[model samples]
Target: MVGQWSGREARALREAKRMSIREFAAHLGVHERLVSKWEAGGDRVHPRPVNQAALDTCLARSDDIERTRFAALAAPEPDSGPRPDAGRSAAPGGYSNDAELLALIDTGAARGEGLAAISEKDLIMAAAHEASEHAGRAEGTNIGPSTLDQLDADITRIANDYVHTPPMPMMVEMLRVRRRVYRLLEGHQRPSDTSHLYLLAGSLSGLLANASTDLGYLDAAGEQIRASWAYAEISGHNGLRAWARGMHALIEYWSERPHRALQLAQNGLQYADSATAAVRLHNIEARIWSKIGSTADTERAIHAAADASSAAAADSLHDEVGGVFGFSDAKASYYAGATYIHLGLAEPALAATERTIELYRTGPARQRSYGAESLARVDSAAAHLINGSLDGAEAALLPVLALDEDKRIAQLEERLTGVRRRICAPAFRGVAEARALDERIEEFCGSTATRSLPPGSG
Candidate 1:
């Protein structure tokens, strides 16, 4: 009979059952990595008592043929003598068995259980106590509290940086953190840890989705937002759910599906749990309604966003993690400006854009999103051009024309192109000032981020 079972015997049981490491771990309700640890530890490592009991139950379920094979594989070599502790009395409790013995011997030395005069029973007791501690640690989570804290902090920093940082570098950092979260998810973790990790994954995916959209990769952005939505669902985070829906709506809005975008924004409202989320959804709806030329609906959405903003409350995703996930007054004003431009309300568009630019300039330095600010200038320029004020339009477009090439995003170029089109229209076709402004805008659009991307990359 096999007097005791260690990692070697555990490996034999796995082989006897003709099971792969994953299958064996699944059968025993343990992590695959834990199974690998057991097999790799060989004769030196013993599982905790609960895992030992699980092992016993697993072996008992084996058929006679599997048991025979297990016995043969588990038997010690013929030349091998008795184990050093063979003469000791059988361990009490469930450990008194034919095939396996388990204790905290691996961690017991630090507790003075390794001293020469210690009785076997005392050693077993110490080992059993240690095993209980180990089981608690293992079953609770694989990740440490500090690791989760660092990940949460990283997400917050990334969110804040997204507003000002270039998209390509942010995407790289996002992918790296996403990979870490994905790896943590692959191993065993507590339910709470799993939920926390999924939230992080969803946020990172949402950022990637925005970056993809900015780079003109609508299909890839769609995939990323869908993944974000899935992770949000798994984590049961209402804030992430609302945010993901808004991102999906944004992608569809840029894809020229205004109706679908409107529907998505409205649907996202159901998941909005905070003022910021509600305001974000309303603003998105406003933009889409304006895109579809529904002035009354657009006005209603803008009003709704204002009302929501008045009821601001702390939200983990938006307020607590205030970066790209946030909806600031400046951004909201920018959206209103853009909607006014779409509805051809030159006076209100100019007013809204002026407010938008003022808010960005006077707000927290970290909250200033250069791309949004530039887009506001473009909208202001468009309003001036509509009002037949070439001088006003030129003044509005000064900063936009001076932006670095890498800072020139797709939306910025698209807005500038709109201004160029207006300048090229019949009313301004022969105006020398409009003609010069049009040429400058054309040059500005030529060296944009999307244009500079490697061939077919976007």
Candidate 2:
């Protein structure tokens, strides 16, 4: 297992423990970037001896019988009294340090539900005290309900502009706003005002989580998401709760936990009544089922998404958070195309992508999200390539390739890479048209790599 480890195994082991790359790297006393390199390399890369030894040691401890025993083992056992001192807080608003917080998360995970179910009255009070301690670091700015409302609007703008805006600037702005919200909570205010501030903090944390994920800092993303959920719980906002759950599901899906993603999406629906978040959650489930190649489940999810979309429209409940919380006609079509692709239904994939392209073309320029449209085109081009229509594939991809570097995202880069791989099959390897396509892709990808920000920007 030492030298034979692959990226799949590496990723699976880390995910199995719910530890992010940075967490795992720290566990091994290595750099986070090295861990990412190993995971990204898949089977092609192997670790040096020291890392191999560490990885083997990690794997052994991960499955250490005493550590990872069946939860059922405790079912008939007597309840033990509380330990002498309770573990440190993992809650963002509560914890004094990252190491203590993470150790707490892991310890709780080993048990059932961990600290997530801990709702002692003292938790928020501790968080408030921590906020007060750090209040000195916050910039001096008077704030109230109006400021919180403006924060909400600013988050929405950032979410909408996420695709085209440079991530560093956006992430910096989000952090600045988050600090302000935290400091406001530190000060005394009316109960209603406190609730509003919590809402803003929760939403801002969720946005920061999204940006962290986009920059490939999964550990940081996980941290922000935890904070988001904590704030959402404190605020008692149904919409924010649903959005937070949906975001969690989305991250899990991206992290290769499709079944868990579906479960989270289902849970989110409990708070989603005629809310646009329902549509987003349903689409997430649909995508998960598609990955699992379950036609019946996929169909059910798609139908639920359509029904939810219709209800949200009738109720006039649009998602104010545009990036991940909302689904456009183009986005839905693109997702459907992705589902069909995973299901090996080539014709359906093609049709869905065609619809997506149509929506992007006919929709208002301002409404056109570059990320969604580019992904749809990549899907379209891939469908064409699958069907042996090289000309059509190239034509479909021209618009995507012509987009400016600033508009390109990691997701788009990934899809384009997949497209290139498909077109490089032996059947097309020597074809003149295939060669042209490959060259174009190489040039485009090279530019993208060069222009890309250093990983972990957020």
> Cα lDDT of all candidates, in order?
0.84, 0.71
Q: Give candidate 1 regions above 4 Å deviation.
A: 1-140, 454-458
Show where candidate 2 strays beyond 4 Å: 1-142, 312-324, 447-451, 454-458
What TM-score does candidate 2 reach? 0.64
Model 1 is weakest, by summed lDDT over 10 consecutive residues, at 92-101
Q: Which predicted model would earn the best lDDT?
A: 1
Instruction: For candidate 1, list the clashing residue pairs, or say none.
Output: 159-323
Please write out the lDDT profile of model 2 over residues 394-451, one tens digit for every residue: 9989987887665555566667888888888876878998888888887787655225
TM-score, cand. 1 vs. native: 0.75
Q: Highest TM-score: which candidate? A: 1
